[model samples]
Target: MILALAIPAILIKEPWGPLVLALGMLLVASFLVWTLLRRQSRGFPQPYEASGLLEVVLATSREWLWTIGPDGRFTFSGPISRELIGYDPSELLGQHYSRVMECEDLAEAIRNRAKREKPDSSWSGLVTACRHRDGRRILVEVSGRPILDGQGQVRGFEGTTRALDVPSAHDVASEETRAGVEAMLISRTLLTAFQPIRALNNGNVIGAEALTRFLSADDRGISPEAWFVGAASVGLGVELEMLALEAALSAAASLPEDLYVAVNLSPKACLDDRVPALLQGSSIPLERIVLELTEHHEVTDYGPLGKALAQLRREGLRIAIDDAGAGFSSMRHIVELRPDLIKLDRKVITGINADAGLRALGAAMVAFAADIGASLVAEGIETEAELDAVRQLSMNAGQGYLLGRPTVAREEWKLWSVPVHLKRPASGPTTGQHKRP
Candidate 1:
């Protein structure tokens, strides 16, 4: 009845796991509902202990052990219970287990467990609410096992309970990072920088990708990756992405009207209703904005996203899949979403001049984009040889340090014409090279 699991890290980092857990929880609920309707044989009350299966789930130090006697009163509550519920094991003795549980349907859970067949009596993944000493509701995941005597008679119940809201070490670090993001958002300390996307045909800057950067009060620049990842960890991913888009559009207002501006957003944000609303209010025309979907998280549902994007397309906004050819989901993203453009990942473009396999992959991308009527943009082109290799493949557009580093000051956009400084020629002539293949 209204169990919510808000594992921010899991939601952002491992979306599939939560989806599986949600399915499992639903199945468990269905079984319980069936058992209640059938009123299956109610076994005698029994004692419970930590069985091997439960030991594995409770192996983590964060888990707390709990046991209930035949009378449905907690006989043994672990030490962590004190920190969690403000009640020590001694204090909780002889207290009804339901006293701490906030869920009204827990009685149903207990009733369903009573009808379990002997020697096979165990129920897990019962998500419910628990009350803290301060009366705040805390979500808890519980599993219970029925303890039996040598005669196969029920004795009591033993099980493990863990708080779903507990934060891991990684989560703690993420919280600190989120604090930084909050400060940046509140103080408006963030800025949008433009990285030129050049037309390989004439080497003139065709457009630019909007990149977000945070100015650290300590004078150390924060990486854009950290800012975005931290924002996702704190449930502000869509907000932060939208903020960057708005900033980029505002800054790009000074840019030449002929050039389009590209902005990166996660797939989750693309499905948000606010996306179209944000676009409509921006000074940039829909035709001049390219919304590049980042591959930071895998998209499980494409149907609704496709429809939302279809609406955007009708409004003249273009879609581009960012970091293509970097992972298994690239092809799936291309086929399902059918983006207006595809941006080759930096890894694929880095050493294409000498790597035969990369060269072949680049050619395939060019051919595929042409077949699909979509433009292909090569990213992170930091060498003359890399540029030359892409030009030979008849690539559409490119962006990297070779073209120009991202700059917040619009006047510095002219740096696109300067030759990129290279440590060494990329296995080819630096200046004079062969014409396009």
Candidate 2:
């Protein structure tokens, strides 16, 4: 419209018409150029805003954005990965995802997501473990989405990693606890002590439960339970359990071949593929190693866990349910797992000799074990009466302070030829002590 009007004004040559036409033509041309530029600019990335928001995000964000091929090889690793894992960006390329992501539970979660996710879907909110380039382990929250090709095949994976935030008093406490546990693990400051599990019939030492004690920097001892809880909080439960198991196996190497060694593991740790790998490398015979499945946490899904345990059992490993009768759920655990041994909890065995109800409960456990073809091991037999009580109940095994405290001396274990207190009458004074040579 402006051009049609401008042409008439230019042709008439009216004084102001030429000037008006000139300005009109100029305005029309400028408008056309502006429109074309806008269309062209749409094909390119948007110009960065003056606020520099993208630059601010790239500079300040903590998440490590990453990409990996369908083959699980890293294709790109963000700067945060290099900073947190102590690896150069180039070092991560071509490395298998599992090389950096080693935790069993996290791997299982990833595998499950891959199996269940729809094409082009994303999974997130998973807190997982990743190995630092320095050989340390750190907990991170990971979120990932699958990248798909035109034909709908998964071509690659994209993800972000963020450091797990310690956001509450409980989390802060957990972080402190994890730091303490990590320090102990790094320093190898934990001491493995063996508490003898004796046959109640003759008090003959048939096996021993391996216990771990963290010797703090101040030379004070921290209980195994506390250390283990801390480890679980930090996603280091399996690793620390492996360490304790390794220590137990090392100590077992020097003991008499006839005496089996019982090592405790959480159900989750028991299912970890790393457990079997660790076992394979150890010289300890499968039959001589009893993996006592302690209720570190409740067993939620027993099918998969039972299958894993069954595999180990097929390899000649024995499974024992520790701390039975501490709660009713423990009995359910025994029934579901069908372990070879049921350890009566200290609470159940502590005063059974005096408390008739306790004695009856102990007897019931013995019968339950018998019905299931399992042996009952009574723990926390702290008195002669407790010993006599469990003996009457036909307990298959017993372990307690009264029998023997956790001993560290290898000579003492080697010289354990017979039951140290077996000769004493069950009615004898509780002081019938077993002296370690």
Clashes of each: 9, 0
Cα-based TM-score, every candidate: 0.56, 0.57
lDDT of 1 by residue, 1-437 (tens): 23333443345457587676677577668978888756643442222234655555545457668887765567787777876777777877765554565222353334334444233467675545565554444556678788888998766789877775533436775577567667777777667778788888777787888877655553122235535654665787787887777788788787777788898887788778878887878899999999998754457888988998897799899999887876656667898988899998765775677668888999999999999989999986766777888888889888876666667776676554454432322445233211110
Which model scores highest in TM-score?
2
Write model 2 residue lDDT over 333-363, tens digit each, in one string. Answer: 8879888988887657655666678778888
- The best candidate by lDDT is 2
lDDT of 2 at 198: 89
Off by over 4 Å in 2: 1-172, 218-221, 419-437
The residue pairs that clash in candidate 1, if any, are: 46-154, 46-155, 46-156, 47-155, 47-156, 47-157, 48-156, 48-157, 48-158
Query: What overall lDDT goes with each candidate model?
Result: 0.69, 0.70
